[model samples]
Target chain A: MKMSFEHRDGLGLLRVEEPRIDASVAIQFKDRFHDLTQNGTGDVILDLSQVDFLDSSGLGALVGARKLLGAGRVLELCGLTPTVDRVMVLTRMHTVFPIHPDLVTALATRAATS
Target chain B: MTGPGPIPGVIGPRPWGLTLRFAATPVAVRAALSAVDAGLADAGAPDDLRARAQIALAEACNNIVEHAYPRHPPPTEAHIRLDIAADLGGLQITLRDRGRAMPDGPLPGRELPPLDPGDIAGLPEGGFGWAILRDMTRAISLSRRNGQNILRFRLPHADKPGPLSRIVT
Candidate 1:
């Protein structure tokens, strides 16, 4: 449940360093994500390029993170692997979060709009 | 450390498959998934099929760990037995556990949570497991007998010809 954060050009970038976010670490992931983004503002992009597997519990944690961010801020996701993307699509969670192909596209798109 | 292999004590005609038994805990479930994936890869299953199978299996096993074996009471040393058999037609899976039966003697509804983009906070955080299992699997069935719960399902191979022979078409 390791996460690294950086503020890149007005966008908060959070990278999930773990390879898998399953039931074993879902709670830790939610609590840690809250601690890191509690004071942040604006849209925060989560980079999941390193994650290979995410079960339902992990998906719940992602939703929990979004709730923790509140209404004003947004929790966007980028770089979902094949398996992770399938889970999102199957569960219809893709409709809720603004997903991007990669971090570069997310940053560029958000920068252009802002 | 339990890995993917055949259990000799079990009496049955097993052609091509692997069996693994692990403690019903989150950490053990995670490890069991990896082992199952490795076994599938060794059996030459395609990536797409393996990915979907893994997701469905994870949800099923997690249910057993979270619901069947209660945490507050600190359940006894309950274990889950997973049996997977792969052939040209598809992959068959059977999970057995001595834990408590499913709620009300049936599986949960497969309906996904309704998402309202306007109200982000109103969205659901859970209740997606049954939907995933239903979408990714075929011919799912559950039975409880003699204090044992046995869940079975099948994951059909892709229509494309690959390691697993394409039976449909």
Candidate 2:
């Protein structure tokens, strides 16, 4: 569960360094992300470009991370591999989370909406 | 969602298969996925097929890890067996576990909840494992025998029906 955090323009960018975010690291992922976002004032956006695979546990962890943020904060997902995107769609997670095609696009959209 | 549809009669020994036994733990799930990656590489499976297989396998394996053991005194050693059938045209993964059976005595339905972005509480976080499996694979069969649950998932590399698919159908 390797992650790199960057702060830019009042937004927190968390890039998951691993290629597979599956059952193997689901718990660690949830815990680590929660810890990093403990004082997350700005909205957090996750970059899943390196992650080509995701399972149900991983999906649960993503939602759990969101719930951990409570109501005001936000967690967005960006740059999902096709397989990951398909799983999100099939599981109806596409509607739950705000997904962007890429990180640049995600940031731009946030800027526009904000 | 569908019942254990038709299973193949040719249940002979699979010569071109890789069997890995691991404890029902998170670390073991990674090792199992790596083993599947190796088997797919050896069989020259396409990237798309490999990706789909990994996703489905992870979901299935995780389900066993999370629910196989009783909750009261969480057993640590709920063993799981993964068998990868890589016989040229099609790929199949057979998972066996001797722990707990489905509470209702059947595979759970894989239907996802209705899409409603407005209500976050209504959106389900879990219960998406089985549905993801069905979406990824062409056929999935589950049968419990001799106190062991056997789940088989098949993915064909080519569109044309191979001998194995024909036999199964």
Candidate 3:
């Protein structure tokens, strides 16, 4: 799994290019989360546009990232494929993290807020 | 006591058998499922049973990769073996892992909690695995032996209606 990170203004964008974010890839995801939070940037937008499939472990990684980001920080997800989106909905994680249709909207919302 | 208790289905002519070993990584789950799907097609298993088997196997393998080997380096190893009776009356699959032994506990059994209506819309992400296995398979067994945890599951043959009278009455 390869993750690219970029920061524009105050909003941080992390794009994951992994096809499957199931059990096997959870650790790598966790590691990336650790790297992202090391800077203490609190606000993040995860662009999952490239992820097609996700299971419980992937969900755990997202939830874990949210917890690590702390109260003031925010973690929003964008660009979920239908299958991945269904998994999120099935797990009810769709409610836990604010999800947007695309990265543009996600960043726009953050820009508007900040 | 002595040797490994006779490999599960050695008696008589074993109807169907499949053995595969793959890197204990997530990708292997998809590969394993594809192999199972192909094998079932060759064996002429019912479509529904094949689909269910694939889902169950994938979920079981995912659990092994995630829970058993959390945070481990890449290239760990796992093994899978499957046997299906000719009569289609029984299907057995075994998954073995060399990672840390899983916590010994009662095997997750049937009896799913009702899917709450409100919660259904935003299903909790984490706990769906065991539920999927419980719903899909007839029997599930887990054990730790020889420094490895082996999980096995079985599905009974589909029941056929005995007669028109039995079905109607």
| Local distance difference test values of all predictions, in order | 0.82, 0.76, 0.66
Steric clash pairs (candidate 2): none
DockQ score for model 1: 0.53
The TM-scores that each candidate's chain B achieves against the reference are: 0.80, 0.75, 0.72
Give lDDT tens digits, candidate 3, residues A1-114.
689888877768889987767676777898887786669575788889998656667776777677677667778899998656754654446666789999999877776876
Tens-place lDDT digits, model 3, residues B59-97: 788777777777756443444444443333557777777
What ranking of all candidate models by DockQ puts the best one first?
1, 2, 3
Ranking by TM-score: 1, 2, 3
Winner by TM-score: 1
Listed in order, each prediction's TM-score against the native is 0.89, 0.83, 0.58
Model 1 per-residue lDDT tens digits across residues A1-114: 799998866668999999989889999999989888877786799999999999999999999899998889989999999889978877778878999999999888887887
List the candidate 2 regions with Cα displacement exceeding 4 Å: B1-15, B71-77, B87-89, B158-169
Show where candidate 1 strays beyond 4 Å: B1-15, B72-74, B159-169
Q: Write the per-residue lDDT of candidate 1 for residues B1-169, one digit (tens) a residue.
A: 2333322212122346879999999898888989988877655566887787789899999988888887753365699999987655577899999998887755665677777766878978888888778777877999999999999988887623321112111
Clashes of 1: 0
Query: What shift in Å separates residue B19 of candidate 3 from its native position after superposition?
Result: 6.2
DockQ of each: 0.53, 0.43, 0.12
lDDT of 3 at B112: 30
